[model samples]
Target: MLLQSPTQTVMSLEAPNPLSLHIIHLLMLIKPATSGGRFRVLRTAVSFFYMDPTLMSLRSLQLPSVNTGFGGSADTRTKDLPALQSALLQLTQAGILTDEDSNGNGLNIMPVTCVRAAMLIRCNTLLRGHSGVCLELVQALLLLLRKGMTPIVPLRGSISASGDLIPLSYLAGMLEGNPDIRVRTSTSFVLSADKALELAGSEPITLGPKEDLGLVNGTAPSATLGCLAVHEANKILLLAQGLVAMSCEALLGKAENYHPFISSVCPRPGQVECSATILHFLEGSSLVQSLKEEDKFKPVELNSASDNPIIDIKSGEVYSGANFISSSVANGMEKSRLALQMVGKLLFSLSSELINPTLNRGLPPNVVADDPSLSFTTKLIDISMAAYLSELGYLANPVTPHVQSAEMHNQSINSLALISGRYTLQAADVVAQMCVAHLFAVCQALDLRVIHMTYLKALRTKLVSKVLPFLNGFDDQVAEGIYERLHETIVKSWNASACFDLQERCKIPSKETIPVLRDHLEEHEMHFVSTRPLQRDLENLAYPTFTQTRSEFFVKPPTKQFLGRASLGLYCFVREELGVHFHQGLVEHPGRKTSGKVNGRKKRTIGSWVSIIFTALTNDQVWGHLVEALGSRTCQVRLV
Candidate 1:
């Protein structure tokens, strides 16, 4: 059950779930006196927290300490304690801590959502022998999380060689009621941690012996942040597949590109899943009738016990291990960050293709719905995309290789996992912006391509009809043959204008039986149908240019009609639900050109539309559609 708060009581918490049953079972079987007691308690508390926060008593969780002389300075009872506190310095190093005393009370803060998750791994080492002294810390942390107590701490600090000490200490300081350690409440009220805790309905925790160290003495900070980064990356990974399918439709790319046979020969699990997902999302695509790892990723990172001086309750013994090192997590986060950059590069490539009229197949220049000469649609977007990509590339630089020795060489070759996790999250946001930009361009391109096809059809009919008048007076003998020749000539010219190489190559039998397959196979039956008369008849003929008659054909496109089943849903959601209408040039602008308000609200820009979609992306509203399109609904694909 979820604990609403420490004093909120069990009656107010949510009902028990399966995970809660597991915790209950563990509590029954695992004695608090055994070597596995710490594991049991950690799993119980975390699982219970996940079930639904409930007001569970820490009294039942407290265990008798048999080995208090082994862990952190808490075991020494203030006898020659080492000065390892560096909250101020760590914040200063990150430029977020500016207080002379090093308290970053009023500075920018990162809301660490994964702190609760990290506590699952953090409390593992804490409960070994010092459970009673700091059992309330876990309770206090849960309160902070429920109340949305965001620690006003910088993202830097913590080599993570001996857990995420520097960062976790800030967290610990917040719980211990450090008056200078700041936190922002759920209501955006920034104040001291002690005050925030009071607002959260908890009091400052008093540190005893190793209890303070216990609060920060694990890889909780690094692993917690890593979990957040990895989870978000995984979500984006799925979202990317759906978007790539939309891009393919906009570009009229071949469906065989994502064919299972292609991935079967070179099977990598992640690649296979991605291909399958993209292919599935392309289902029922009218456009696609032509078109189309994470395993053990959690091995040592988020789940590892990063505590120092392990306590064995049953054996009454303590052993030291390098479990506090978080290199594995650090490495994954760095690679994940690098992967985000690669994703941004792909988005750049796709956006460039969509905007370049010459490269975007039959779509108009820049996918501009208005005069291509005047409307620079998506140009600034392209530049912004590049800026985001460059930033992503910079963030993707490996933080592991630049590790500086910390704690006077005691943490030499430290794992900068926290830094890596932070950058990974940053890269994810950059890639997300790239996705937003690409989605906007792709939607515009889709509408333009659909209209372009119709316009071409209408223009060819109109243009070919011009030569009709010349041959109209002729008898049925030559007129039929002459008009047929004119049709073929005009078709070739228009096709060549869109894509030059398609002029000669034979197209398969589509709805039109294509050009080549219309009269059986052109290759097999070579009937030389040339027309010097038809060309001469149209020599001085004046047909409407795309600029002249473009207005008639540029009506709002029925996007769902041409899209595949997956893309159709996305298009409908974007247009209807999100209200991010098609990017229609100047009318979309806010200037006096189209009056102030289109319909009462302020005039919308492309950025406004994109921002709406981006907000939905962050809120996972679009992800819900993606899962529905995939034909199955789970929470999400958890990477770790």
Candidate 2:
């Protein structure tokens, strides 16, 4: 039977549901001091039920008193009962909230991250087995996750010190079925709060005494963003290593800088690990040269940890500390940006070398025919590489020190870790593009060298012997045999154009011919050049050609998607069209191959060679520029 107040009015109703019956049972348990008090409790309970039918399970719940008075004594509540009730009433009423208002906007965080951060807070609280939150609240969180409902939370309003109150209140509002609040579906569509709840088959949950407090107090936002940033940054580092190695091979650079002995002397863990990884990639490569005294290498530095106020689970204590700040992650990203900038700079230098006549050994100026009006020049390639490098220079500025605090006086200091992470991602993307440009230029240079080898026979012999000494003992007949086999493979596999076909060329007639030979003779001539000769020569001579129609020339540019696909060093021009043999055994050194092992190790492949060369190039550029920037180097080595 339910207890009734003297002033209570009865109403006719249909049969009650399981949830409504549970609410009536809870009403019977409460014994208020006066009719007014009983009426207030009844109204509040009914309001909670309407807001969230899931609160029915919380009918037997009891909350820890806020007035437990510091040391958890039971008697102290006598003096603080009224104050506690007042505070709880204020907190519950605050749930009528929304981030979108006439004066300000909502949080800019993605719906997924916002929901994930909230989930992290809940998990942390439950795992500690404290925070005074009820089992029903746990069930409600699990239901939210299972149903894939992402509550809209504010990014700017979180003070973080007062437990991220304003932002988290919006989340709490969603759970209590605040009609004014909105939710985002897993597909990223926004829906009305009630409509979303119905579709998810989830009812809203009422917040018990300290449940609101438990939901907001932690470093979830900072930690989540920081963790994501760290993960992406690590991947960029791996990719950067490959880019560095390719750049090194393109520039004909030495590998001794990454030798273990050099890193072992200094013994910085990050540098040592970086050196080992780079050296492993360079193994068995013919392109990488021995280190000279003039060559310099930079030391590497990397960090993989998060910073402070960690919750100690064993003691169930929240230790107030600096762990919530993410300066370390931001600093690491800043360094990565600098490293990416160095790669961009090196690419610019390599581009210059490929185009300038005097610097590219014996290659033609602009890497085209002597008559520039008839051939494709590398001018556009150089300009595009410069543009990428300039963008990287702008992105390399550190974001760690650019933040200012604004939340009352409580949050007096701030870390721009999130911003730093965003900048790092952008810089990494640009670095990948720059690497593609460098690879294209290198492949073009190699093609030109092979095509004009009749005039460059002495230089070609020297280069081939220096880069691939294992072919030194082969007779002309034997070498020709190898060339024939390689030519067959290239003809079958080649995909890109082998040479530019002359679309009809215009010719001007003399004035005398136009007037006198109008009917008897032709006034002008047009010529068309076929690429068959170059294509035939590429197969017969075991050489590669950079062939395309005038209309097709310079059509492809380095893009993020293109770079992502090309990072493994396999592309139309470099791999299929050129063939591995045209690289003069730089990719697969014949001497390094054994029946089972070479030097007691497995033989490396063409892809491994490309990765190592790019990684070494990237490392040299980053560390070299860093040393120069710090005024530690008296003279920088010029790539030209």
Candidate 3:
């Protein structure tokens, strides 16, 4: 019995459309037992339910006759009941065996029947949600996931798939009054199917013989989960592409790495699309000449019949086939799991390049927040990523290849689609964690790169004015020839050492990088006008311009003009929109809030910022904005 009255039940069942889009017609068939009325018509609209009794009955059908052709009475068809008795049975999902499973679709039927029941203390128990609800829904509920505003339903959304599609058309099926599904020895879940309809002030929800073939007997459960995995994979793929572009900029890569012709030579659709997308993100980037990957998943439709001996009403024929086998979903999920591991491997390589000083170009070792010796900020994450990568690689092994027969071998060659789908979701999660770590390293390295370039620009300006003019005074009449050679040498040498010469380790300058720049100048070979003095002066000027005590440029991050257009947008969004400022190394470790105080907020760690971006991606807050931010930047070719 409902603790709340009918009106309260009605109000609770009315889920507001979050996006404010109209829900057109959702047709429901409700049949009454022990009456001439074959079935009742129930139409659920945007916010209310209305019922209209349709003028149809089982008595009108000519069983074993010429017209309807729903033959019966020849051999006690439909659970030993006469043809008409089977059609009019009140227990909607039973009284006639539709497939191998005589009573239910083998799902935990409580959630399906009790989807909108607004369970009010049945047997001193209430509807139980997953323990992780708070972790998952807190952000959406606090911000975007209003009553009717959700287009993405949580795992529980499958319960309402039959009558409502909420945001996605992925899972589509329904159930009627089935009391047998509610009968169980255990008290877990436990709800009557008719309880929800009782709230609508209508008769019990039950389906007649024709509508009771199968809804849940097929591949919907595993297929729906697979669809969700596919959706998440797309988000991960796109974010990975953006991360690749940002990493390339930080590493000062040649943009030519993702050129169209390189991808076109191979021309696999996935590889081609990925390469083109990276090229688009690296547009206008000076780095692989520059560098640098949404959602469309089509598996089995959840509404399709998955039952054997399907009755075709229009043709009046019963076809027994194996439509219930879920091989498509099984193999699809298996391959998706492997794909996730592959993406994780790519992230592993990129992240290692960012943190390792030798591979990260001029960035500090470990890409630390401050002094390389004192700070090991990214070392933990780097180690964690190795663990994550290993787990992901292990998960990539095929789940379908190890199928086992079940049900006394009557059900041989099992699909194991559900198990495969579950593993795919697990793989997606690992890759997502890997992506987060990589992004953190990329953002830090990008900042250091920008600052490195900015200081070089300032130091170069002082050198050209002071040193170049002084060199021209060496033999004034022939000065132009000498000046041209010296000037060429200065420009080339300055540009070459500009990034490499300014290591964060040599903050005092000249101890490490200056000597290296002197040798690097030997390659430019400006011997016509000596450059050793020129190199020394440039080294001396680098200190006051970037030291902790006396530096004009150290206080401010480098001007944004040094960033490529694609990378600049991503960098600004991370800093400005997410409110995750650059890490100040050891200084940020000790937070502002008192540790024991419950009311005050503690300082967020570097991991916290990465998690924030991870949350945005998981909740789908970034994709729509990303499409707008990166409009048509992808390479396009006319398909033949």
Ranking by lDDT: 1, 3, 2
In model 2, where do residues sit more than 4 Å from their true spots? Answer: 1-118, 152-173, 284-286, 290-405, 416-640
Which consecutive 10 residues in model 2 have the weakest lDDT in total?
32-41
Output the better candidate (1/3) by TM-score. 1
Per-residue lDDT of model 3, residues 133-250, tens digit only: 1111122111111111111112222211121112111111112333333321112222343432233233432322322222223444555555556656766877788888888888
Alpha-carbon local distance difference test for all models: 0.59, 0.43, 0.47
**Highest lDDT among the candidates is held by which one?**
1
Per-candidate alpha-carbon RMSD to the true structure: 9.4, 19.9, 12.6
Instruction: Find the 10 residues in a row with the least total lDDT in model 3.
Output: 123-132
Which is superior by lDDT, 2 or 3? 3
- Model 2 lDDT per residue over 1-640, tens place: 0111112111111224222211121112111100101111111121110011123223432222333321123234333333443353345334333445211234354336434544533433333333434445545554565566666654454423333344455556666676666777667666766777777787876564445555544444444444444433444444345445544544445788798888778987666765655555444444458555311111110110111222233343433344434455456667767866775786678678766755654455556533334444556667777887888899999876666664443446656655565666567667666665556556555444433333223323322332233234556675555444433333222211222221110001111112222221121221223334433332332222222211122232221121211122432334443332222222123444435433333445434444544554433333332222223222222111
Best by TM-score: 1
TM-score of 2: 0.49
Candidate 1 lDDT score at position 123 = 46
- Candidate 1 — which residues are off by over 4 angstroms? 1-15, 18-108, 114-134, 291-296, 459-492, 495-556, 592-594, 597-602, 633-640
lDDT of 1 by residue, 1-640 (tens): 2122111111011224323211122122112211111221223332111101012232222211112222232233212212222322233223246652244343334443544345444544343332222345655665565566656665566677777766676677777677777775656566887788788889876554335445666777777677667767877877777788999999888788888888899997767777777877777777755542036344344334456544443343335667778888888888788777877888899898888767776565667776655677798888899899899999999999988876546567778888888888889988988988888888888877776566555545654465444444456765566445545555444433442222121121011212322232243343434434444333323233444444544444566888875687778778778877666676768764657764344677778889998999877678667778888623333344
